[model samples]
Each structure stands twice: as structure tokens, then as C-alpha cells.
Target chain A: MQKSYLMAPGPTPVPEQVALRMAAPAIHHRTPQFSRLFRETHEGLKYLLQTENDVLMLASSGSGAMEGAVVNAMSSSEKAIVINGGKFGERWGKICEAYGLEVLWLNYPWGAPADPAQVEELLLQHENVGAVFVQACDTASTVAHPVACLGKLVQKHPRTLLVVDGITAVGAADIAMDRDGIDMLLVGSQKALMLPPGLACVGVSTKAWEKISQSDMPRFYFDFQKERKALAKDTTAYTPAASLITGLHEVLAMIRQEGLAHLHKRTELLARAARAGLQALGLELLAPAAPAASCSGARLPESLDGKALVRYLRDTMGVTVAGGQDHLEGKIIRINHMGYVDSFDIVTALAALEMALHRFGQPVKLGQGVAAAQEILLERYPS
Target chain B: MQKSYLMAPGPTPVPEQVALRMAAPAIHHRTPQFSRLFRETHEGLKYLLQTENDVLMLASSGSGAMEGAVVNAMSSSEKAIVINGGKFGERWGKICEAYGLEVLWLNYPWGAPADPAQVEELLLQHENVGAVFVQACDTASTVAHPVACLGKLVQKHPRTLLVVDGITAVGAADIAMDRDGIDMLLVGSQKALMLPPGLACVGVSTKAWEKISQSDMPRFYFDFQKERKALAKDTTAYTPAASLITGLHEVLAMIRQEGLAHLHKRTELLARAARAGLQALGLELLAPAAPAASCSGARLPESLDGKALVRYLRDTMGVTVAGGQDHLEGKIIRINHMGYVDSFDIVTALAALEMALHRFGQPVKLGQGVAAAQEILLERYPS
Candidate 1:
């Protein structure tokens, strides 16, 4: 039997223990039992983020939290700087425009990391800019930005808050919110948390809360202030994605037990193996400058269609990876390494890629990529 | 070891089969496999609703569907009639008001069902009224409104559509939307579908879609048209609550196997037994006139605190039930028997109530209620 492998950046494979926790009989959200569980989750999230800020848990996708961050922290016509490097980075600009905010978009090519110096110059020019939005690691291009470097720049401007969409970056790599001077950090359940996609946690710094207080935005469902009021009592503003939160509780426990440093190290090793294996096969890296630990982007061989290769891997080999979106479509394939995945997943993905390339009439020898990945895995585990 | 029981009107007990289905490995939503599964779910939901209309699946609580129904079908400042009998009914008016709709509220007493004649008169007098919102069964008061009668009245006014919030009513009772002239019907996964509280399904009639096409409302996340467009391709507009939808697939299969008529009959028997048992102990039903088959609401004896009794049942007996909200707080206890529940659950609820009442110094003969419930159960399901 060919067991299927999920290798997507988001909706990543969940640990069986976390999945089973959601399978247990449902509990009412208003009960004491649920409150205790929610509190435990709060502590676990704080520990994971390495922040003392109040992290608000919401019931929608990470985009919903992104929207909340925009409406809650910025008012209409308020100036904000958005670093547009990839699809997710571009989302920050789109959301700002939607909320009637004056966006100063700093555009960058896909697969290119954002330059902190460029951001600093923009912030200095537009001193009235109330917020700066960027992704810790843009999943679309598999590029990681220097959040700590950007945080240092934004922190110099006390009125400007730095909001990091750490949806794919948080657990895969350590960019501690408090230590890095990040004003807001967003993390979703599916990416690196080993749970299904629904719950989104937004860690809000006190500085960000001050901006949220003065903002008069039309919001009911995604109101951060309403959520903050409820969260103080260990409840959500609305009915939470309860089962997802329950799953989050178990995954958080798993994270706490494994420790963030170890989890990040494992992901680093997986990404390293994937890069080593793909490079060994003569494939060019898409984000070779600063590839994200969560996922690796590689340019498909000139003869191969990335979309068709992705489909073949999913349908024929039972291995699921992602193709590029928008303009990058049919050009790159992204192999995700974060969340509940290990060295074996890298081998499977590389092996499947090698077979797919050979089937597509490329000059790829069998076991070449797999052998390279195995070398890295063995050196790390040494068992 | 004692096992806890979930007996809430919503977030009811989920079957083990459905829970286990959710625990299976995650699947990417954009894949062909997921598209096929989503299409199958579309067919299953249509069968459950007994309608030929497009039933759109959403990723939020049932209230999100309710909000979508309001914003999609009616324009700003358009007049609408709302039947306010309980918490859920009141919510319909509030959502309409939030969107700047001119609401003509027909306020019914908490336990009283809506009168069709009043709605008919309002529809005739206010010919410009665009829609009428009513709950098939108001969970807060355990009252089932006469939706069939109401639909007939609203149908006479071609411009007015009948929107039914069937969150607690759809699977637990028989309300054929097409036959009863309902334009929009909403259902949640958590209630009688034996799943958790995240996914909502909205069935839209051609008549309602006509209005939705012309209506202009500010919406992004709850855009019905966007969801309908994506659903045509067998996917959701946003990243769906995948795990909950996975659970829903199994529960819908269970519903199909049990047959809609049989499932409704089972719920009817359970509610009947619960009412019979509680009444035999000299407790009066809160909604004696038109009690909902999904749950039974009973007024506490003058000497008992309904809140304390509910807490005792949960904390001591491991049987969880609900207490009344708003004005009826500490006056009524709502015993739910919907979704993955059987006759045994009714007996357990009655037995725990008897024990709780006895401990609370009330004159409750221990086995009197259980005996009455057993008699009804035997008649309904005699092996």
C-alpha cells in the first residue's frame, strides 16, 4: 500500500496524537473544562512565541487574522509601509488598500528577500507611517526576511509598529517576538503547528494595542478589542473553531515537550536535506539567497512543467507538494519541510521528484537525489 | 473512571465514526481527490436538506451563514420582518440591523411560537418588505415555529423571501424547503449533524439568488457569491475548516444510512421520552405549546436553582446540559437529545436530574422519571 504524503507549506501533516485529541467527545466552550484548556493553550502559545504579549485566538484562516491586524491597528487614511516580496507579502498591501489605508508599497521580485535598509529609508521618508507589514517568510517564494533586522529599524520609530505575518516562519525558525522587538506576530494552526487550518493566533505587543485603541474601524466579527476583552476571561469573542483549538492544545503540548529549539533544528535539517538532494540532481534553487526553513522552492528543469509534475507526484506517487502561484506558475515546485515532517519526508519528496523528472525525459539517475538526502539524514540522526 | 457526556443543544455529541474520519491524514484542498470528496459532500448535503438548490459550505459557525444570508439577500435600508421568539431569532434582527436594514420586529414571548397571521398582515401592509427571517426551531426557548405556515404567507408576497435558520431544526425535523416555499435555509455541522462547531451550509433558492444578485452589501469573508463561484469548482472561496468538513462527510454518510425519516423519528422519540420523564416528575415544560424535538426545556421547581442543578449534573454526574439565557436564567434547564444520541441518553439525563433534584432537597422520587422514560423508549424501539 502506498501511503500518501502531504508536503504542502500549509495544511501540513498533523501528528496522530494531535488529530486524535480532536476526535475525543466535544466539550462546550463555556464550561470550566474548556476554560482550563483554553488557558493552558494560552500559556503554551506564549511559551512557543517567547513573548508575554496577549495572543488573541480567532476562528478563521490566517488571512482573517491578517485582516484583523489591519483594521485593528490602523485607521482609514493612515499611512502604512508594506514590503511586497511575494504573494503573502503582496497580501499586506491589498488588505491595507481594502481598509482605506494609504499604503507605501516597497515592491520586490518574487524569491528575493526584503532589504531592511530599503525599509529603513522608506520609514524615514514617511515618518507618519503608523505601521509596517511584512512576512517573516513568504511561503509563495520560500524566502525568509530578516525580521530581527527590520524590527530594529521599526523600533527606532516609536510610533510605527512592525507586524510580522509569521504564518509559515514562526515554529520553523526562531524569531522571538519580544527579543526581536516585533510589535505584532501572526501564526496559524496548520503551518508548523501540526493541526488543521482554522485557528489563528495574533500576538499583540503593548505598543500595537495602543494603536488599536485609537483606531475607529467598522468591525464586529474580527474586532481585536472585543476578542481581547473576552480572552481576559479565557474565552473568545465569538464561538471559536473549538475542535481546531482542541487540536491546537495537543500540538502545543507536543511543541512544549519537544522544545522550540529542537523543533526548529529538525526543520532546518529537513530543509537542508531537501536542498542538498535537489541541488545534487542539478536543479536550480528558486530562493537560493535565503530559503525558508518551512519550505524550499526550486525551479523545475526547462523540459518539465511544474504543474504537471506536481499533479503526477500527487496522483501517481501519492506524494503531495505545491506548484507556484500567479506569474511563477508552471516554473517552480515548493517542497515543504515544516510541521510534523521529518527527514524521511524529504527523501520521499526527492525520490518522487527524481522519478517524475526521469519520466518527463530529463537526465536524472535513479537513487541519486535520495542518496544525497540520506547522507544528510544519517549524519544528523547518527543512529 | 467516569466518562463525561455532552448534551448541549449545539455542539452535540459526535459519533466515533465521524471523529475517526477527521483524525485521518489531511488532504490538500486544491487537489483532484479533495475536489471529488467536496463534490460528494455537496451531493450528501443536498440529500440531507431534501432540496435541489446549491448548498454552499462555509468555514465559520452557523451565525456566519446567518450573516451571509442577511447581507447577500437584502440591500441596505431594505425593510425586513424578523420573528423574535428566542436568542437565535433575536440574533436575526440584530444582524439585519447591523447591516443598516430597517427591521420590523414581531416580538413573541420567550417560549411562544410566531403567529403566521401576524406575518401575513405585515407582508400585505408593508409590500416593500424584501424578506422575512424566522428560525425553524429557536434553540434558546426550545420552541419550533410554524415555518410551513409562515412560508405560505411570505410566498404570497412575490418580493418577500422566507429565510429559515434551520440550524437546530434541519436534521432533527422534516422541513422540505422546496415544498414549503422557503427561499433560503441554513444548517450547521455541530447541531444535529454530529460534528463540531465550525462549518455552516446555506441552501439558496433561485428566487433568493435573484435578490442576492442585485443586492449591494459590504462583504469579503462572508461573500456568498464568491463562495458559490468556488463551490462550482468543488472548493471553497477561502481555506475551509478542513477537519470539521472531514468529520461532516462521515456524519452525512451515517445520516444517509440511517435514512432521514429514521433519524428524525429517533430524535422525536428521544425528545418525547425526555419530556415525558421530566413531566412525570411534576416539572412543567418551558415550551409546552410547541416544543422542539431537538431539545426539551423544563422549568425548575420553585425551590431549585436551575443553574446550580445544571452545574451539579455536569460536575457530579458527568452529564452536561444547558441552562436558560437572558431573562429565563436560573429558571429553566434545557435537556438536549440531538445528534449521536439515543433513548439511553434520555434515560441518563432523567436519572441524573432525579439524583440532582434529590441532592438539592427537592421531592424527586429516584426512578420515577427513568421508569416513565423507559416505558416510552420500549414502545419506540422494541427489539
Candidate 2:
């Protein structure tokens, strides 16, 4: 059986060390051993999130934190301006709407990141908006939303919390949530954390907490107050995902050992090589924004179906990639270079894409993409 | 570092193998590999829950599932009948109250099981009750709440779903969800599964489904309908705790390999031997009515504090026995012999307990507990 290399966004390829951590002995959550583990994890998460705000560690997916962000930060007293350009941005709107929060939507096409000017314009127009949700790098668009700029402008509206979904962005990008005026930065472990998705971490600003106290929405499992109280005791509000925590411990230790800046640089390098290689193959970038940017959406020639190409890459070349969701399915393909990625991975993925496109009868130059990627790598990185 | 053995009901010791499985690579939730894993896990969960109901999984702790049961399974047309005998039981009432549901609580004293007669009487008296939530075993009390009689009685009120919090009960005891006619059987992976506490799995019967549809509670993250829909698609409604799921895959495989029947017998044998050994050491059990079936919840002599004994167990012997909670603290030391345990583990725990007691100047004899435990094992196995 040919096992395809998972190059799509999280769950990213977990390091063997982290996976081993998860498979190790289960520690009692309340025991001193686990408390020390939990305490260390809390410290590590705060460092990753770049915040002094007490983080709410959840045992659900990224969306659970999204729901928590919405229910805890926004109330019926004011509307939330949801700038939806991608799937996750749309999700923020849907979750808030489900809780009966009035929404002021600023939607854009799926391919491009929402303009910061557009979001700032929306915030100004919708004065009643108490919160604004944006995806730092919306996975569907593969474009890095200008959250630091947008968050700064939203800070002007003190009542409007700048809630950013950093699910695919946080550890992959230079995210200083505290420095960026982000009120609530939510991330899942599966993506940039280089672990599985069972653990969700939220970086909350004091501004968000003040809103939480006054929010009339009925929040239970993901309640900030409950989570805060638990964190005060150096534990989770609920029995936490212990193995995931162990994985987190391992992943964090790996990152710390490697240095966060070094890890981020590696991801940037990987994304750069992937983008350079894909461009050389005559594929148009769906969003050619930055190395930190993901979805990493690319379009095949109009004659070739992107969906079919995704399968071809997987079925033939042993490289699993992502197909576009909703309207972009047959038009766009996503190549993920988020966590636990190295230069050789880029070579393997490019080789697969080249082979798969060749099989599709595309008039392509063999090994041209790999050569181009190597050229850029040689020029930029000594090794 | 003195590595301690976890003697808590949950976040129990993870099997060496399960920990290894959790350390596997993190895959994208949408990838074909994840699709295969999700499908395998969904099927594995159904078999483990012993129910044909839609066994939905969550990326949260067991408390999340308990909250899900409260917010999704019970209808607003009627009140929630909660049986509070321990911390978990009180959780049912708290969750119900959080959803603004009218709560009818039948609370029993600590260290005692909820009487089925009381549950039946409450259901009969309150015809408006839509559901009754109880524990199969109260870990805080170390008392097994017999669900056989409660299951039979709750059957009469088919509309009044019987929700069993089997967090500490699932693999530790002989509680079968389907055979017992349980509408909602909730289990946390951290306890009897010998895994960490990141995932919460629930057995939702068809009756529970109908009631869920009628539920007026507003929920997004814990919504059963959304989760069930995602389950049908062989994916989680949210990004799951993939590491936890990976760990779970390994743990369940081990369980199925051991077979449920044999596991139950081993657990019973271990529990019996441990309890008998403790009793022979002159420790009096707190649950005089039921022999404290799963965990050996016994009070040390007045000269010893359970808390200090627990500390000594950890500090001196590397055995982390649990001290009683609430008013029971310092009075009773609960020795856990749940998942990932066998004869030697119980013997080690018993010997540790005896040594800890001896250090406290309370123990009457040496090797007495081990000798008694040996006799039980010999008589039971006859080998």
C-alpha cells in the first residue's frame, strides 16, 4: 500500500517524538506529576501565544474556541462584524449567528484575503459592533489577512474585540497576539503546533475578559470564567486531554529546543520553496502573499481539473494534498507547508506534483520545478 | 524524580502501548488517512460503548460529554432529574442549571451509592422529568452505583432517558450501555480506557435523539445534531483532539484484543483482591453497604491522616494513592485499581498502603495485606 505524504494543513505531520509522547503513560490530571506537566504546558502555551493573559486550554477543536470566543466576548447588546472571505471566517459568522448575536457581515470572494481597509470601513460603519472576527491566514484563501493592522484599527473601537482565528497561522507565522492588539487569538494544536488537534488554546486579552463578564450569552463547557478559575489552580476547567497535553509538552520542548524564531524561519523556508517550485511548474498561485501564508492555494491550467489533480498527486505520486471547498473545488488545489516541514519535503512534494501533472498529459518540463526550487534554496540558504 | 503511580480514578495510568500510539504522526483531519482513522474510530467507539446508538465523540474531557448530555439529550418541556452522590453526580445538576433547565436533584451522602428506589420514586413523583442522570460508579466515593435496577426502572419512562456518567465505570466495571437500556452512556478516555482525558465519547440512543431534537437549549460546540451529522460523514463536527484519538485507537485495540468479558473479570478480581487485602490490614471500608466495589475506599486508623498517607505513598513509595474529597478527606484513602492494572499493580498498591500506614504507626502487622491478597488471587485463579 502506497502511503501518501500528508502535505495538507493540520493535522500536520506530527514529529515522531510528539507521537511517542501521546502513546506514553496516562498521568493523573490532579496528581503532582500531571500538575507540573499542566503547569509547564500552560507556560509553554503562553509563550507560543505571546500573551500574559491567562490562556483557556480546551479539549475540543479550534471551532470550540471559536464558539467560546463568540459566546464569551459578544453579547446581544451589540452586533459582531464578521469579515468573511474564507471558510473559517464564514464559520465565525455562523457560530455567532447560532447564538442569536446580531451580525454585520463584510464578505469577500473566497480566493483573496479580506482587505484591512474593508474591515476598518465595516467597523466604522457598524458602530454597534462589539467584536470583529478575522482569520489571520484563512486556510481556504491561503492569504494572510492583515490582522495586526485590522486589530489595531479595531482597537480604536475599544468595545469591539479583535478576535482572530490563528488556527493555521499562529506558530506558522510571526504572531505576537499581545503586541498586535488582538483581543482573542484562538489556535488548534493540529496545525502549526505540530501535534494532533485534540487541544485548543486561546489567548485572551483583558479587554476580552471584561466583555466576558458582561456577555449575556449562556456559555457552559467553554466558559471563560470556569476556565479561568481552573487555570488559577493550574488545571483545566474540565479533565483535560492528557495525552494531547503530553504531546504539547513534547512539541513545545522541541520548539523551545529549536527556538521559536528558528521554527518559524523553517516554516517560512519550506513555504517559500513550495511556492517557488509550484510557480515554476506553470501553476498560478491562488494567493501569492507570503511564506507565512497557507492554504498555499494553486491553480492548474484551465484544461486540467484541480480536484482530479489533487487525487492524481495522492493516487499516483504518493503525495496527499487538499482540494478546494465549495466553489473552488475543480479550480484550486492547496499545498500545505505548515508544521514539521523541511526542505526535502518540498522536493518530494514538487517531484510528485511534477509527475502527477505529467501523467495528466500536461506539456511540462521534467524536474524543472525541483531545479528552480534548488536554485532559490542555494541562493537563500547555505545548506 | 520519584515517578509516582496514579491511583486516581481518572487520568489513570496509560498503558505503555496506548501512549506509543498517541505518539503517531498528526494527519490533516480532511485527509484520506484521517478519513480512514475517523471511520475506524467511529466503529471502534460503537463497539466499546456497547450500543447501536449514534456514538458521537468529542474533543473535550468527560465533563464536556456530561454537559452535552444535559444540553442536548434532555428537553426543555420537562425538568432534569439528577442523582447527586458524588462530584460527578453534582455535575449533572450544575450543567442542567447552567442551561436554565429546572433541576430536580436527589442527592445522596458522600461515599454512598444512589439508591435505585430513590431514582424510581423521583421519576414517578415528577412526571414532568424528561431525563435522569446518574453515575454507574461514583469515583469520589469509590462506590459503584448499581445501574441494573435503575436501568430496569428507567425503561418504564422511555421518554425519561437514563443517562449514565460512566467516566470511572466504563472499562473498570461490568456496566454495558446497550444491555442495560441506557439512553446516554458517557465515558471519558482518561479513566478506564487507560488513556489521557482529552476525548469524551457518548452513546446516544434513538430515544435520546428524539429528545435532543426537542431540546430548547442553545449550544454550538456541544450540539449533538451537528456532532451526529459530522459522525455520519466520518469526521468530527470540530477539529478533534487527533493525538487523543490516536491514543484511543491504540487503547481500544488493546481492549478488544483482551476482549471485554475477560477485562471485566480481571478488574473484578483485582478489585476484590485489593479490597480484601486492605480489609485484612485492619482498614475499615467507608462504603459499608456495598463493599466499595471498584476502588478500595477505606479509612485508616485515627492516628493516620489519609492525606498524609497519600503523600507518603507518593514521596516514599512512588505510589500516588488518592485522598478523599470534600468532608471525606484525611479520613479515607482510595486505592485505585482501574484500567491498565493487574495482580502485581494491586499488590504493589497494597504493600505501599501498608508501608505508609506502618510509617504512620497505625499498621498492626507486616505482609498481612499481601498475604491476604495472595490468598484471594490463589483461590480465584486456582492455579
Leading candidate by TM-score: 1
Q: Write the per-residue lDDT of candidate 1 for residues A226-303, one digit (tens) a residue.
A: 999999999999998899989988888888888888888878888998988889889888889989999998898776
| DockQ scores of the candidates | 0.01, 0.01
Model 1 TM-score (2 dp): 0.52
Error of 1 at A299 (Å): 0.4
**Ten contiguous residues minimizing lDDT sum, candidate 2 chain B:** B374-383
Give the residue spans of candidate 2 off by over 4 A.
A289-292, A379-383, B1-383
Tens digit per residue, CA lDDT, model 2, A1-383:
12347788766888867776787778888898998988898898888888888878899999899999998888887898888878888999999889888888888776666678877777777768888898888888787878888877988887889998999998888888888999999989899888877889998899999988988888789899899988888898898988998899888887778776876776776677778888988988877653345447787788987787887666654568887887777787787777776544565566566656766688776455655564444322221
Q: Could you tell me which 10 consecutive residues in candidate 1 chain A have the lowest summed lDDT?
A: A374-383
Which RMSD does model 1 reach against the true structure?
25.0
lDDT of 1 by residue, B105-126 (tens): 9999988899998998888788
Q: In candidate 1, what fraction of native interface contacts survive?
A: 0.00
